[model samples]
Target: MLLAIDVGNTRIKAAVFEANTLFDAFIFVKEEFAEKIEIILQQHPKITTMVVASVGNLDPSAFSSFEKRTKIEFISHKTKFPFQNLYATPNTLGIDRMVLAAGAVLQFPKQNRLIIDAGTCITYDFVDADDRYLGGAISPGITLRYESLHHFTAKLPLLTKSYPENFIGNSTTESMHSGVVNGVISEIDSFIENYKTRYAKFIIILTGGDADFLAKRLKNTIFANSNFLLESLNQTFQYNQK
Candidate 1:
């Protein structure tokens, strides 16, 4: 059995896997180390290999303690990844992003792939069928778009990022929502439009917190798997083990 943990800026997701099949998982928000991990250890005592991809300030000491207690080694950025890393700064690359590319490779084994992770930030990564990571692009998410407007302007209140009443907004709140959500839709459309000119028939995979929120809003069709990063973690762990 294997244990994969993905620690994001706002929350943490941990999943148990058995022979390439995910078992159970849990989501933990930002909180001090309580008995939560201890409980997890007890629940999956058979988890022989542990992998952690953290985007936050994760203490190595805690994972070390798990190693000592569960007799399982931890997989990290230091762990060898299977694909050829093309990122200019490998050390600076986010683990979540790496896992995502790995996941894309496994899911669409022989096809060009594009992964769009829409969370606190939106990241666009691509991988070739030969397992070449072509790198990715990143930008502020919808919420950040709203927050930026408020921060940049004096009277513009911090509007929530959601679907607009209509594309043609007739009010302030509606206009803000339209700018954030509809803007994202158009931005994605433009990216796809350009990418299509370069690559023919690359599969588009979308995931992350804001994925569902804007999945239907997308102008172009996309495959949405909210647990993509976790699946990627599992694949990465297995790849390193072999």
Candidate 2:
């Protein structure tokens, strides 16, 4: 068994994998990570190797407990990836995005892929058919948009994201919903359109916290999987071994 951990901006998502199949999964806040991992370890002592990918400033001590039982691999720019990274500032690339790009290549090979991860922030990462990690864009995520409005202004109340009934919102809360939700949909669609113009045939893989909410709303066809990063972490682990 393999243990995979993806520490994102807000949460730490961990999974136990038997080869490519997911055995079990759990998520917790960053502060609770060490305790959660301890529980997971107690439950699955057979996990021989662990791979971690983080975009947050997680303390290394949190993972120190795994040293005795599992071989830990924390992904970094130095880590071997399946694809050639062409980003100008390679060192500055987020490990989460790198893992997602690697996941795209592993999941759907020999094709142009655009991976949209909608978590704390929305990130678009592209990997061409030739297996080159071409850079993509990033924008404010659904929650961030709502929070930004409230944080930046005094009167606007902080609202949770929801699917608006119409583009023309009737109420104050609905208007915020319309702007954030529909605006994201439009932004994603526009990115897809622009990518299509450049690449004749490609696949869009949408995965993240808000993937389910945005999947049906998207005009472009996409393969949505919320646990993509974890899966990719496992794949990267296997690839690293080879």
Candidate 3:
């Protein structure tokens, strides 16, 4: 059996996979994380492989200690090039982004694909037909944009709700909400239009926190996966074993 983990800025997720099938998965929060991680690993003592992807470079020493306790193979790359090196400086590209796009390419090979992750930040990544992970764009997520406005500025207050009204805003809060969500919707629309012009029959995939929220608003159809990075870790495990 293989255990996969994706560490984001705010949470950590775990999945147990056997025979290329996911058995179970859940999110372990930070408040009582050490106990939760220990319990999860204790129950799955026979796991032979462990794969991980993180938004930021987590201290590998911490993970290494856990792997030593579990007797499982740990896989993580700070600078390893999994796919063709296209970026000018491969070290700057986030491993989470690489895993996410590579997983999509594994699922849908020989096709142009767009992966939009809407979490701490919204990222758009493209994989060309050649299987090269061409880079895309990144923008503030719905919540972060709201929080940034309040945190960075003096007058603006923080917001948690969303607006489904027309583009124009009526009040100060609505004005901010409209600008964030509506602006993203337009941004995605324009991106899709530009993608379609270059590639024929491209597949669009959306993931991360606000994927469902944004998908509901955008007219462009997308395949929504909540555990994209988990699937990517699974794929990465298989790739390394081969």
Candidate 4:
């Protein structure tokens, strides 16, 4: 079995995969990194190889517990990927985004792909049909929007994410929900429409903590899987072995 870990800005997700089939998956916060990973290690002794893709400030030492038992690797710009990265600022590209692009290529071949990750930040990454990764955009995510509203302005209390009761919010909390949730839905739909105008037969992949929340609201067809980055990490590791 192979262990794949994706440490994002907000959460750390780990999964055990036997070939392409996922055996088990776990998600936790960074503070629980050592404890959670240790438990996962104890539970899945068959995971001989571990690969991590991180876009957070997690210390590398957190994985030392696994190092003694498995061959571990971290994904960086230096890591080998199947897709050709054409981003102007290659060093600035997030390893998580790069892995997602690689996963799209491996999972869905011969097509243009747009990957939207909705977590701390909503990131849009595009990989063309020819397997060249052209950079995409990033925007404030669901939580960020709520936090921004509360932080930047006075009297707007920080609110947990919830779908707007109606498009036309009647109260203060309702308005904030509409602006944050409905606004993001509109923004995503606009991006999909624009991408469609330029590319034909393109596939949109939505992943991250807020994927399920946005999936129901999005009008465009998308393959939504929250574990995409972890899956891609395993795919990248397997490809490197070959």
Ordered list by lDDT, greatest first: 2, 4, 1, 3
Model with the higher lDDT, candidate 3 or 4: 4
Considering only N, C-alpha and C atoms within 3 Å, which residue pairs clash in candidate 3?
A: none
Cα lDDT of model 4 by residue, 1-242, tens digit: 98898888888889999999999999899999988877988899888988989888898987776677999988888888889999998999988889999999999998999999999999999999899999999999999999999999979999999999999999999999999999999999999999988887799999999999999889999999988888889998888889
Per-residue lDDT of candidate 2, residues 46-115 (tens digit):
9988889989879877878779888988899899999999999999999999999999999899999999
Query: For model 1, how does the per-residue alpha-carbon lDDT over 104-182 read when each residue is reduced to its tens digit?
Result: 8877888889999988889998888778888879999888888899999988989777678898889888889888898
Candidate 2 runs further than 4 Å off: none
Alpha-carbon lDDT, every model: 0.81, 0.93, 0.77, 0.92
What is the C-alpha local distance difference test score of candidate 2? 0.93
Q: Tell me each candidate's RMSD, in Å, in order.
A: 2.1, 0.9, 2.4, 0.9
Model 3 segments beyond 4 Å from truth?
A: 43-45, 71-82
Q: What CA RMSD would candidate 1 show? A: 2.1
Top lDDT prediction, candidate number: 2
Q: For candidate 3, write residues 87-198 as lDDT tens digits.
A: 7666787877888877887888888889988888888888887888778888877788888899999999998858647577888888998988888888888888898898
